[model samples]
Target: MSSVWAKKVNSSKSGFILSTRASLSRASIVGGALGFPRIRLPTKYLGMPLYKGPKKSFLWDDLTSRIAARMEGGEAKVLSPGGRITILKSILTSMPLYLLHVIVPPKSVMCRIERLFNKFLWSAKGQRRIHWECWEDLCYPVEEGVLGMRRLQDLVNAARMEGGGGS
Candidate 1:
């Protein structure tokens, strides 16, 4: 029967060809995607936190104990410049991005990750401010670089591969 033969053909295809292909193209399938969360601190600067204790300063110590607790716990999500751009792109692509931008600043685990990579992985100075760059910079190429941070688009693709797409 055609149905039986068709099922056999479908089963014979490699999972990556059958499954991975869709995931790779998920961003294209989904109209919008959720990005990493931004912080909720009431501040004007895009990356720095607001210091509201005695005088307005960016000093971490000036914040109240409650706020300090958040900081010590690394409450501020550190995004790499590349990740920041992805968040920005997400904002540009959909209503949620605008809403998230208006509601909060971007946050991530990237602050420390970027710092460590720049310092140890690149064997660079650990004392300087790290300029923001794209996430791809942190990733090893399919060939050369070490495996680190997930590529946003790749993640989007993976989601698609997993059949997580929507209209």
Candidate 2:
């Protein structure tokens, strides 16, 4: 069965890796017979890391760096609250939505992102000012007398629910 599948797929051209527990090292035997190179565990597939076990903070380091890079700038300081909100909703939040839909990030990562948002919204430089309301209150619907900012966890929940996770 495996031989037949291997014969059907030209693995070298396809960039497919044969991942197995057995230590099959000889390329002449494994590659010729299986038509693929042996790969180590935790290979990346379609930009997301593919590995065994629960999601970890290291997996999200690149994404967090990207979010932090976007949040840092003189432009963020200059923008009004509404403009900052626009960037948060349209640019910053959307950056991680694709990953969030697939895996739930750790609490520390979420907190870091939230802190970046809060700082951009309230502070201009090293100086800090009192936030008029907590982040949760600010994330409420506009009709509730707050900015209609969607929380990252809430967005992940919604995505999970839509993907049939909710009963």
Scored by CA lDDT, what does every candidate get? 0.35, 0.72
lDDT of 1 by residue, 117-154 (tens): 33322222223454454445655453664344443334
Give per-model TM-scores: 0.22, 0.73
Best by lDDT: 2
Q: Every model's Cα RMSD, please?
A: 20.6, 6.4
Q: Candidate 1's error at 112, in angstroms?
A: 15
Model 2 scores a TM of: 0.73
Q: Whole-model lDDT for model 2 versus the true structure?
A: 0.72
**Candidate 1 stretches greater than 4 Å from native:** 1-128, 141-143, 162-167
What tens-digit string does per-residue lDDT give for candidate 2 at 1-167? 35544446667544435446545555447667666665655666565666666766676677878888877776766777678789987898788888778877787778778777777677655457787776767788899888887778888889878542211
Worst 10 residues of 2 by lDDT: 13-22
Considering only N, C-alpha and C atoms within 3 Å, which residue pairs clash in candidate 2? Answer: none
